[model samples]
Target: MPTPSEDGNASATAPTATKCDSEHTPQPQSVCEPDHRRSVVQNVVLIASVTLCMIVNTANLTGVSISLPTIGRDLHIVEDKLQWIMNAYSLSSGCLLLFFGRLADLYGRKRLFLCGCAWLGVFALGCGFAQNEITLDILRGIQGLGAAAAIPACLGILAHTFPPSTIRSIAFSTFAAGAPVGGALGNAVGGVLTQSTEKSWRSAFWFLAGMAAVCCVGGAFSIDKDEPYQLDDRRVDWLGAFLGTSGLILIVFALSDGSVAPDGWKTGYVIAILIIGVLIFALFVVWERYLERVQNGSGTRRRRWWTPPPLMNVSIWGRANGKLGVMLIIAFLQWCGFLSFSFWITLYYQNYAGLSPILTMVRLLPMNVTGFLCNVVVALVVGRVDLVILIVIGTTFTAVANLLFAVIDPAAPYWAFGFPATILAVFGADFVFAAGTLFVAKVCLPHEQSVGGALFNTLTQVGAAFGTAISTIVFNAGLTKASRKYGVEVHGSVANAPRPAQLVAYKDAMWAGFAFPLCGAILALLFLRGVGVVGHKTGPKVVDSDATTNEKTVSHPWPTLLLVYQAVEDR
Candidate 1:
C-alpha cells in the first residue's frame, strides 16, 4: 500500500501548489535559513565540516597500509592476523550502516550525525593508544561504528536540503570527490608522518582523532536543529535490524578471514558462516514483507519500521532516475577494481619494482591527480549534459583501462603500462562518481531523500568491502597454489619476505585482480543502458504555495520545499 511519501504527490503537493497570499498562510519559524546570504553561509559551513570529516575517515582507513609493517614489528602481529586491523573497521561499518541509516530517518539526522562524529573521535584516540594487536583491532571496530553513522548522513543531509537540481549536482560532486582526494592526501600524510626512526604509527590515528574532534564541533554549530520529524512513529523493528546487521557482518567477516584460514574454502567454518549469512539475509527480506502486510491491514497509511514504501515502490524502479542504482553499482565495481589491484600493486612496487614506501606514494600521484581533475570535469559537464551518458562513457573507459592493466607482463615498463593504467582507471571512476550521485539526487522525493542517499552511499561502501575481501581470497588462493608448486611454505612476512618463487606467487595473485573491473563494466552496460531522461526541463521552475490544486493537477514532480531553504541559498 502507498504511504504519504510513497504516493509522491498527494498531501505534499497541496501546499506547494497553493501560493501564500502573504496574509492567509503564515511561514513556519526558521531554524537556520532566514535570508539568502545566511543560507549560503550555513551551507558552506556544513559542506566544509562534512568534507573534513570524510577526509579524516578515509585517511584512517588507508594510512595503515603503509604503516602496517612498523605496526606488525612492534605489536608482534602474526602474518595471518595482519588483515584483521583493516577488516575490523570494514566489517563493522558495512553491517551497521542500515540500522544507523534508519535511525537517522526516525530520529533527527543532525543528532545522529553529531553523535557519530563524537564517537569516532573517541575510538580513533583509543586506537592510537592501544598496546596490543587485539586492542587495536577492537578499537578500530568501534571507530568504524562511528563512521557508519556519520558517512551516510553526509549525503542524506545534502539530498534532503538541496532541492535545486543544479545545486544538488554540484554538492554531490564535491562529496564524491572527497574520498579519492582524501585517499591520495591520506597516503601522502601517512608516508610523511610514519617516516621517522621513532616509528610513530600511532600518530596516524591521533591525527584522525584530532581532526574528527574539530570537525564535530564545527558541524554541531553549523547544523540547524528543530523539533525532530517522524515518518510515522512506528515501533522500531529490532528483529529485522538484528538480522540484517548480523548477516552482513558475518559475511564480510568470513571473507576477510578467508585469506588467513587454512585450506581456504575447504575450511568448514568459512563455508558455514557464508551459508548462515545468506540464510539470515533471506529472512530479513521475508520479515520486511510481513511488516508491510501487517501495516497495510491495520489501516495505517504510513510506512512501517522496515521497507519504507518510498524506497520499495516499484514505480521508482521504472523511472529514469531508478537506473541510478545500476550506475551506482558500476561505480562500486570500479572502486572494487581499484582496491583489488591496489592490494596487490602495493606489493608489486615494493617487492618487484623495488620502490620505497615514500616512492610508492609518489608514483601513485598521477592516478590521484587524474581522479581529482576528472571529478571537476564531470561536474562541469553534468550542469549541461545527460548523467547517464557521462556514466556509460566513464565505465567504458574504466573497463578498457582495467584490461590494459591485466595484460602487463613481468617485464612491462612503468611508463608503457603502469602510468597509462593509472590515468585510465582514475578517469573512469571519477566520471562514474560525479554522474551517479547526480542521478540518485534527481530521482528521489524530498521526504524519502535520506534513505535514497543512504542506499546510494551504502551500496558503494558495501561493494568496496566485498571487493577487497574477495580479492584477498583470490590473492591468497593464487599464492597457495604457487607456494605448493614451487615447494615453499606460504607462511610468514608476506610483505618483506624475499624469495624467487614468492615473487611469482605475488604476480599470479595480481593476475586474478583484473576480473573485478571486467565484471563491473559488463554489469553497467547490461543494466543501465537507455535510462537517460530530460530532468527539470519541463518541470515548474519553483513551487508556489497558492496553487495547491494546480500543483496536483499537473503530472510534474512536487518538490517538497518545507525545509529546503538551505539548498537554494547561493554558495
Candidate 2:
C-alpha cells in the first residue's frame, strides 16, 4: 500500500505529517472518491422518498372529506361537529409550521423529518382504531403536528442539497405537483376504502399509517446526513411560538364554531375568543419587532434572554416588487377556493347526484388527472413565462369554475357543467401551485429558504382551514334557512336532505366560494402585474445606457404587462 503526501506524490518515506499539514494531505490509495453515479441514484431515491411523504400528508388533508359523511354516521357525530375532523388537522399543522421550521434549521433536518414520520405513523394508527369523533379528531391533530415537522424539513433538505439552478427549479416543480396528485389520489383512495363494505372508513387511516411507515423506514436510509448549523447564542423563541400558535388555533376555532354556536358570532364566548385571538396575534407581531430591535442593539454581545430570530425574514415583506406578498395572498385565496369547492362538490355528487363513493371518485378523478398533466406542462414553461400572467389565468379559471357550479342544475348532464368545471379548477390550481412554489424557491435567500417554504405551506394550510370554516358556515346557514322554509328538520348531511333544501344550501355556498377566486384575480391584477422572476428579464425593455455606471434603466412597466397578457392569451 502506498502512502499519500501533501504534494500529490506517493512515496515510501514521506515526512511525518504534522496536524497542520495533514489537513492538506490526500487520502491513501485505500480510500475512494465518492461515486457520482451512486450519488445521483441516492439523490433520486431521496427525492422520491420525500415526495412520498408529501403525498401521504397532503392526501390525508383532503381524503377525509369524502369519508366525512360515513364517519359522521358511524360515530354519531353531528353535522357541525364533523367539520372538526378536517379542521383539527389543518389548524394544528398551520399553527405549528413556523415553530417546527425554525426548530429543524436549528436542530437537524433529517432527525426532525424521521421523528415527524414516526409521529404521523403512530397517530394515523390511532385514528384507525378510534372509537369516537373526539378520539379521531385528537389523533388527526397529532398527525398534523407530524406533518408540520416533516414538510418544512423536507423542503429545507431539498433546498440545501440542490443548488440554485434549473435542476432545483424542476425538483421544486415536481415536489409541488405532489399537492394536486396527492389530493386527487386521496379523494380516489378514500372513496374506494370507504365504499368497501368490508373495510369501511377505518381502512383509510390504516392505509395512511402503512404509507407513513414506509416513508419512515425508506427516509432513514435515503436522506443524506447533515450536521445542524451552529448558532452561538440564538435561542428558540418559545414566547413567539406560544403566541402565534395559540392565536391561529383560537381564530380557526372561532371561525369553525361561529355557525354552530347558539348566537353565532354574537355569542359572548365566541366574540371573546375572537378578540383574544386577534389581540394575541397583534402581540406576537409587537414581540417579534421588539426582539428584532434587541438583536440589532446587542451587536455581537450575547444577552441572557434575547428574542430569537423570527421564523420568516422581515425584509421579505418590504421587497419593492412585493412578489412574495402577492404569492402568499394568491396561495391563500387559491386554497380557499380549492378546499371549499372540493368538499362541497363531493357532497353535491354523493347526496344530490346520487353517486356512490366509487362513482364520486370517478367523477372527481378527471380533475386530478388534468392537474397532473398541467403540472408537467407548467414545470416545462415556468422559467420562460411570466408567473403573474399564469396566476391571473389560473384565478380566472377558478372563478369561472365556481360560478359554473353555483348555477349548475341538479339534473344537468355530466358533460355540461360538472366535467368542464372540474377541468378548469384542476388547471387553475395546478398552475398556481407549481409556479408559485418555484417562484418562492427562486426569490428566497439561501438562509431563509426553509422559512420561505414553511411560510408558503402555512399559507396553504391556513387557507384550507379558512375555506373549510367559511364554507361550513355558509353551508350550515343555508341549510338551516332551507330547512325552515321547507319545514324539515336540519339534522342530517345536506346530501340526505330534501331536494329543495339541498339545492338551496349548495347554491348559496357555491356563491360564497366564487368570491374567493375572484378576489385572487383582482389581487393578482393589481399587485403582481409588474413583478417578474428575480433573475429573468421582464420582457424586452428600452434601456438608458448612461443612467448610471452600475444601473440600467428600462422602459415603462405597461409594455411588460401588455406583453405578459398577450403571452397568456396566445397560450
- Every model's TM-score: 0.81, 0.83
Runs with alpha carbons beyond 4 Å of true place in candidate 2: 1-41, 160-174, 298-304, 313-315, 321-323, 441-447, 489-497, 533-571
**Lowest lDDT block of 10, candidate 2:** 553-562
Question: Which candidate ranks first by TM-score, i.e. highest?
Answer: 2
Residues 388-426 of candidate 2 have per-residue lDDT tens digits of 788888888887788888999877798899998888886
Pairs clashing within candidate 2: none
On lDDT, the leading prediction is 2
- Model 1 clash tally, residue pairs: 9
Q: Tell me the deviation in Å of residue 187 in model 2.
A: 2.1
For candidate 1, lDDT tens digit of each residue in 448-521? Answer: 34444455555666666676677666656665566667565665345544355456555554444456556666
